[model samples]
Target: MKIFGYQLGGEKRSGSIENPTVPVSAENFMQFFGVQSGNLPSVTIDSALRVPAIAAAVSFLSGSLANLPLHAFKPKGDGSERIKGGIQKLLNEAPNPEWTSFGWRKYFWQQVFTGGRGVSWIERNGATTAAIWPMDPSTTVVKRVNGRRIYVFDGKSEYPASDVIDVPFLLKKDQISVYSPIMLGSKAISLALAMGDYAGGFFAGGGVPPLALSGPLPAGADAIKRAQSDIRRSIDSAKSNDEAIFPIPPGYKLEAVGFDPQKGQMTEARRFQIEEAGRIYSLPPVFLQDYTHGVKANVEQQDLHLVKHVISQWAKALEEELNLKVFGPRSNGRYAEHNLDALMRGDFKTRMDALSRAVNSALRTPNEARNLENLPAMPNGDTLYIQGATVPLGSQPLLQAPPTGKENDKGNENGDGNDSEA
Candidate 1:
């Protein structure tokens, strides 16, 4: 046998190769396997957005980080001086001409989830950062030359490592960029989405019937053919409305052919898909709307977990990138940080309890606690008030015995003479 000009199970014929080309690309690999090219997985960012699980994960992460306060601070003594004015406006109000801080953060976070890299251009003024603009990940590429990494934007412009703030997710060794979740779990995501589409179509088409007609046909061949055509027409027409009856001729009976949705495990399959997607994003199943195992008590813990594990990582990445590109190395002790208290804020009771403890323990002043709640400060709120009974261990008592009035009276009576006692 001869296969692609090569002998198989036959005497080999030696000949000098006329032409040869290295198969390095995906297309070439597929061609070698006799599979048609250009059939790449259809799991792009836009397509994945159609999945609820992907949408929820992206939203939860981006929204949580973006909505939280991001502040720049300069270390001074025991506290820090918040960098205000233009810098603060750029962070809290607008990061660029087109997008606000929230929008910018959300866009970059989405990029991280979809493409594994979030890149932005740092626009500067004199010695301070003016604005930060996001670059589309699809058009942005990272290249290394002469032991220095360079960022190429849209294949037209090149930016130095210092000018671009790059946050890569799931970074690997000896690699310039990060690994995308969608790319790594494309097969699973695609399968889940495909199943969802199928289920939607199934329900939309009035679902599968309980049973299908089978057995022998009645009378002549023409009658049998007519009966089959009528049955198909009836089935197709009845799909529009489940209440529509499916009529069958005599001598024909319905027989179970397919498993019901419950027995087929459709719901379980969807639940599994949700869990899989959550795992890919490092999110809890509850965040993806899978509340099967969720409880009210654990929900708060889950949120905390989300902050500690998922949101904190992204926040730290953004903070470091901002500190480096926005503030630069010469900034000294200046750095950016996200206030996670916003995410940790629970109900009224929780907030009040935390504030009470903070104030009573002298960790924060009453004015500081009120400021966090956006309330006005009181006259003496600046004073740090702790529990009157709370005292340092191994320290003298703050209270001392009262001065004796008789001692003072004796000093007055005797003048320069010795003191007298009762």
Candidate 2:
């Protein structure tokens, strides 16, 4: 089968055909030949990360997700409780002696957010998991062989699908090749890099635009060169001395060339790039330190939106992958979950109030809340308690007794008299 398409070689011409196929590598052919020529700079993973907004989005998302507590648990009684040791230790503490859980997960997700995939091998000793080792995706090849997926490291050693944990930013229909974010947003990233370069070169050159020399008496090439040098010196001298005006060569005219930063609306364009970066990652602009549309309520809502829409989705994806690859499809009562509440926590007072409400409303036991807050359990804190007015679903109200018929009588003498008279 052909790697790219049915025709095979991109530069090959069919004997009966007049044209040749072009490969994707030539996508930036124009830029190479034209020397940029006002076209956007080429975009790569490194260049894309150079964009501040893109860098911030990747860092924030990867770190925020990796820092959350991932717990392993099994169904017990009416609910589930966290279990320690084994996979849990590998997930929450250290994946191996060489890497902490946070560090490993951070690197894994860094690849993912950059529109690549992450893969790790689950090292097992007999029936139990022993360690975890990260694999370099760039050198590893993943493909289906005999209807079974496998990982081939550097095209040398092979590992079964059951042992490798794989996560892709996006899966193609074939489930082998994944889409790269750098490629998807190449145009936008290229423009951002170009703008940054333009701004730097513009300011560094002392705001001098292209100038023309006309009506000069100079005859030789050396003389023309000398005249240009003199003009640059005069401009630099004025700028250094903070003068408003600088002298120009006799009978020569200097006109500012190209668009100024103000005319180009550079500020607004930069802000728009930040928004575009955020959009690429499904991240809200506020998280990228852009507050253009961020009012009080919107900023707060954006926080919620981050956890619910972005972080939660990614967390779930990782959790499911771990559960399947680590424990197998028939997990037999064991699974992994991320403590999303960690991200939802607010200020100290608000957090305390929320914990109190959870305990009082019988949503969570006092012991559970205390455990979340990292406090020691109080005596009998495990007992669930609800408001005094709240009762069992089928039980009568405990707050007020049923009104008696004797008290309801219209002509009761004792009811009409004051208690002090008796």
Candidate 3:
């Protein structure tokens, strides 16, 4: 099968003398077996493949996935034949019976079925019932960068046992401005690029309308153009200073960012912004709105809230969810065994909870209950009474006596009481 001008079982364009130029355009590339280019061929392929790049991307991805020896090698296990048998079970059990891999029969069997989790099924009515093949672990690798473990081929063993981690997927200048600071490493160039692109995309996607530009931007063309310029600059900056950038893991953000060339410290700023009503704001220096707020896309409230919660949780403590079963518990060849150790020590929730507990404990005192009782009522809430030796409730001092006992003394002094002495 061919896709985007690339042939299946074909060699990738490795800048080898045989194929010096990779498919620069998606349209001109040959479509793979049953892999529809859907107007890809009609799109013009610029020198750098502007429009037809999608085809090239698809081709590249297909080529990469194809490189992994799938099904070509026979399993040596005594249960070797079980691989194919396992796949067949998954196909019969999948809810979408018609679902098929694009003309890649091996993919259907190897990548989808009998891949990672292998195959499991239920029997019903004396017949084999529903079954599914989890993704294969032999081809996947996930591990913690902090640890000396480098999990490869389903996390079987740590590579090198060294802490020097390799950042996946090298960065490109134009691609710099897409993700958040947390998504990018603390490299200034990457962060700037991300901010610029996010800002540009917001304007481009109609997130912020031109009419809403408070200043400088004349809306529409002008706003978009400015965003584009900003993103371009950010990308340029990122490429030059790769080391300074910090990569944000799934849910974390830079906090309390600052740079001291002497100390060799450039870290994420931990400061957060308080949104007052609808206005957008930020903590100075560390981060800011990527683009003009009015020009960006307005995110869905639910999604934004969820993302915010996740990011906040990550920023505060990465340990809690580190071991969460986002994938699963079993060793089916995915990430680490529950990172319970990480979560227990580094989870944002755990840290936040600990902090809260400490603060509450500090606020308590020996006479807190009595103090609260004597506290004055206010329009908003109760006020703490701290000054008096003892707290007393009600309108008057606790030491004061009723008028009945003091009437005799008062009458002699005033000469006007009902018990007055001449």
Candidate 4:
């Protein structure tokens, strides 16, 4: 978002964040997320994430999903209640001793977004889940063997599909490997990275383009070297003395060589790359902190856009995967769900207003609303309430006058409390 002060680092190291200068294969791209260099840099996940747009998109998505409140639920009567214990703790708290739920899930989704696949093993002690362990998508391979899927980790251990939780950004026809975002969006990402490389080197050289020395140049090779040496010495001397002006040889001049950033349309090109990266994840530009085309309505549409077209789809992908693997085929209607209230924690006033309306309309009990705000329940707050003045759709009006039929006066005279006075 803050483009002017982008903290682009030193030039990319060559022959190693470089590649060993070896050619990498398309098939092995997912295995190692390898990079191949050429006319355009081969986009590996590492290089792709270096682009600010890709980094922002990946971080936003994974971090948002990681913070969601995941809980296991079981059907109770007409609906389902969040069930607590090992499974819930495993999902919402600590998956393994080494990692918290948030940490694991963030890593999981990061892989899903970048490498195009996320995988974990659901460790079990007999029939009960013991702990969950994440696998590196770069090192783990999924393949179908004997008409069943298996996860092979580091080419050694193999896990049955029934015991693995897997989500792919997109599944290939073979269902063994996924189409990596970096590889699939290579053209755009490669351009973004190339721009970064050029920008880094350009700005590092004092934001000045290469200088071309001209005029009265000697034709002989030895003479040209002498002139170049003299020019270098003069420039170095001027710089050392902090002088603003340096003299050139008689009839010589210096001018910047090649196209400047503006001439290259760097700003527009960079902005377009951000939009391109957003498209890879189907994310709205607003979500990527791109406000060039943003307005009030466009910004507000993000919540719906994210939930409907982005977050919910990935969340459902994960939910289905986790459920299928963790609970087996006959899950008995017990499922793990993500509570999306975490996404609406944008600001205090909006959240409070929503909760207030929910409570006043009897959509949620006062205590339930309080629980969302981490507030203690008040006395009798668990009960649902509605406006007392409301009536059934076809019911008689309150405090209505009696009918004017002849029997009405006779009936009232016998039964009404004011009969004697009348």
Query: Positional deviation of 15 in candidate 1, in angstroms?
Result: 48
Query: After TM-score superposition, what is the CA distance of residue 362 in candidate 2 from its true location, in Å?
Result: 1.8
TM-score for every candidate vs. truth? 0.78, 0.83, 0.19, 0.83
- Once superposed on the true structure, which residue ranges of model 1 sit more than 4 Å away at CA? 1-41, 209-225, 236-245, 250-258, 393-422
Greater-TM-score candidate between 1 and 3: 1
Q: Give the C-alpha miss distance for residue 390 in model 1, angstroms.
A: 1.4
Point out where model 3 deviates above 4 Å. Answer: 1-288, 294-308, 313-317, 321-361, 364-397, 401-422
Ordered list by TM-score, greatest first: 2, 4, 1, 3
Candidate 2: which stretches are off by over 4 Å? 1-37, 216-220, 391-422
Worst 10 residues of 1 by lDDT: 13-22
Count of backbone clashes, every candidate in sequence: 0, 0, 46, 2
The positional error of residue 171 in candidate 3, measured at the CA in angstroms, is 23
lDDT of candidate 3 over 172-231, digit per residue (tens): 354321222222222322333333444465457434222211223223444545555554
- What is the overall TM-score of model 1 with all chains considered together? 0.78
What's the residue-level lDDT of 392 in candidate 2?
A: 73
Q: In candidate 4, what are the lDDT values of residues 1-422, reduced to their tens digit?
A: 22222222522223222143333345545433333324687778888989999999999999999999999999999988888788999999999999999999999999998998989989999999999999998888777788998889999999998898888888888878789887899999999999889899899875768787666622444555566788888888887898878787777678986689998999899999989999999999988889998889878887689888888888888899888888888999999989887788877888899898888788899989988888898999999887768877869766878877767677776885346556
Pairs in clash, predicted candidate 1: none
Q: Which stretches of candidate 4 lie over 4 Å from their true place?
A: 1-38, 238-244, 397-422
